[model samples]
Target: MLSKKERAEEDALVEEELQAMGPKGLLGMFSTKGAKKKPKLFLELSKAQQRVQGKNSLVLRQLDGDTMSDKLSTYKKTIRFHILAAHDEAITMVKELRGLRQDVNARDEKGRSALHFACRMGSEAAIATLIKEEGSVDEPDLEMRWTPLHYAVMGKHKYAAKLLLKYAPSPYVTVNRRDKIGTTPLMIAAAEGHASIVRFLLDSSADINDRDTYLISQGMTALHYAALTDQVKSVEVLLEYKAKVEIRTKASGETALELAERLGSHLVSVALFECK
Candidate 1:
């Protein structure tokens, strides 16, 4: 056993060594201060790691979003290109798009389908293809409520009109189908001076004297439209088909001849007068 003085001297030397070793020394292993500080440092490092991981995850998500948006944009542009190609009678390109799983019945903003464009462009071959592909023959547009047949007649496409009539699920329904203003295909044919189409419609069981029952042109027949538009040949055809010459419009109460005279349609007026 050492003397009290010797014990004091040894304790002093141990304190000096501990002070020099600092917090990371062997003495720190049993020190509560060092224990607390180590846990705090570890927590800070973990928080930094989590922040880096969060930033990386956010960047990955943003990249994915951008990639998806680009894909969607590309898809829309491709679809539009194929639709325009259909209008230009690019049947092969359309078929290719269809083969790639694109919707064949996709419509434009105005609800005009591929078949409608095909008819408006007078593409007989494209019309045939669309019909074979199960395109709706009597599909009506959202704007004018005009069917493919109506477009065919409006564009003076006789063959396209014939194809529509031939492929229509119901011939009678399609031939006499009316528009937004209650104007039937025959009425449009007459108004546009499409005499041959008028004759075709009449032969196809279109009501020759079917009247427009919609707004301004209410109670106006095919003959009335022909006469008002100065379509002499159409008027003659209507008369030959036994169109009512005396059928008066509900709005104006004018016969076909009277409407012709009022509209200054000299040729149509003569034809209606001769028929009367």
Candidate 2:
């Protein structure tokens, strides 16, 4: 993921590109006339993964894995439109499609916006489009209340996540928003053992002690998830950020120490017991 500095650099580059377009050219970029110039597309397959491509260029790097079943590639692959060159390509696509009544903010059955698609697929160009649209980035999917940033982190695409964090209207809100299951992105990272994301979320000022609603206890925090899951590095990172392991679940009255102990996570149980 880009730091604030890196994202600023990306913004500067986009500004430079936009400036070079002048006025008429910028207008033409979004016109029907530009549609003919849309890039040729292909599904580039690598091992079990697939990313959409425009001729020789990598346009959208969101991959779908194969599991020996019939490989059903998404026909909407054309939506990419070689926009990977700059997210402005998406802006151009939007303008070209505007004559046909497109709701850029429209949600799918799962309540995921196009921005969610962009993040889940690792499409920097598509992400740029959604950011340019500005209304879709923070939209949460219905099932889990997962935002575009959530999809990005779940995809393990830090660059995409960083882009959302840096450019979204409320980066802090997106970073801290909890899903329906009462888990923060931090909890997801800790439980999934995505140590890097845990660190990134912490540095982004995510609440170290934030807890979920109780499915078992009155909700366990990221520390509890990490301890129970035996994510050693994640537990260490949370502790440094002032995570309170002494906090206990309301129902079972079990601290993370007790949970780790019951789960037979020797390393985490020992750390929490000693710290207490």
Candidate 3:
């Protein structure tokens, strides 16, 4: 009974709604005729919700509390890591995710939450999206104190660390955040070879001199860790940031340069030894 123009307008609106779902659009909702039928994940989603809310109430809520139910759906879907980070496409996804579930939050198996993934992937856009979409920006995962910025530093994603610092710098700067191994982001970056992250943190006014009391004093400063790992560039970067040259690890009783020598890293030793 509708006119052609009205019908066309309605079609366009439906198309827009479909697009609005973003990465989760059309998720297990359709059955292609004659195609091999895949198990419907939404069925599992419904079951999960039913478990949370009794079946009768859930059905009632779906009918009378449609908006709330939609939010719950969005939250559940966001928790799943099925969607790739898709950093390049996060802005639009941000709008959609926020609009769908303003309170969306979730954690992965290793206790690395969405924010952690955002940092590890060096997606500033995704970080912004998570902040604007989810209210739990500063929420630490199972590690209790390790924030997304911490992961960024450990992952050696400088831009991600920078963005995290810019948007949601943890209030507990000097407070040591430990992982399962009681290693701080600074320690992880130092032990491995993430020089850029060390420089970024130090330049951002991070407590370069702070030592982790929880861990054995493996020669605490970013310089000692970098030197131990034979990270030449990292050594130079940390030294430029004024990391102490003479600092020694508690257990090993070795200076950063000594660790570099013992590891057979001549270049790393040269870089650290040459530091004033």
Index of the highest-TM-score prediction: 1
Rank list by TM-score: 1, 2, 3
Candidate 1 lDDT over 1-276, as tens digits, reads 345585456445544443444554321222255344453211122434533433444322332124433322223333343344345556674665578644556554345666776787687777887787787888887768989898888888898888998988999999989888999989999999999989998998999878887786578999988887889999888899898888889998999999988889898888888877
Estimate the overall C-alpha local distance difference test score of candidate 2.
0.64
Tens digits of per-residue lDDT for model 3 on 1-276? Answer: 345585456445544544554533533322245657554333234545633553334332433224544433433344332133324347555655657632235543224456666666566776777766643545565634567767677556877766666665463452245554455677677777776666666666666665554455443566766766777877777777777777777777787787778889899887876775
The better candidate by lDDT, 1 or 3, is 1
Return whichever of 1 and 2 wins on lDDT.
1
Clashes of each: 0, 2, 1
Q: What's the TM-score of every candidate structure?
A: 0.69, 0.64, 0.62
Q: Which 10-residue window in model 1 sums to the lowest lDDT?
A: 39-48
Q: List the residue pairs that clash in candidate 1.
A: none
lDDT of 2 by residue, 1-276 (tens): 335575455445544544564643221332345465653212223423332221222212222324211111211222232222224356565673455434465443245556776676677876776676554667787757888787787777778888888886777788898887777888888887888888888888788888788474477899988987898878877877879988888777888888998999999877777666
**lDDT per model vs. reference:** 0.70, 0.64, 0.58
10 residues in a row with least lDDT, candidate 2: 67-76
> Can you list the residue pairs that collide in candidate 3?
219-249
Once superposed on the true structure, which residue ranges of model 3 sit more than 4 Å away at CA?
1-76, 81-88, 100-102, 143-145, 169-182, 213-219
Selected candidate, larger TM-score, 2 vs 3 = 2
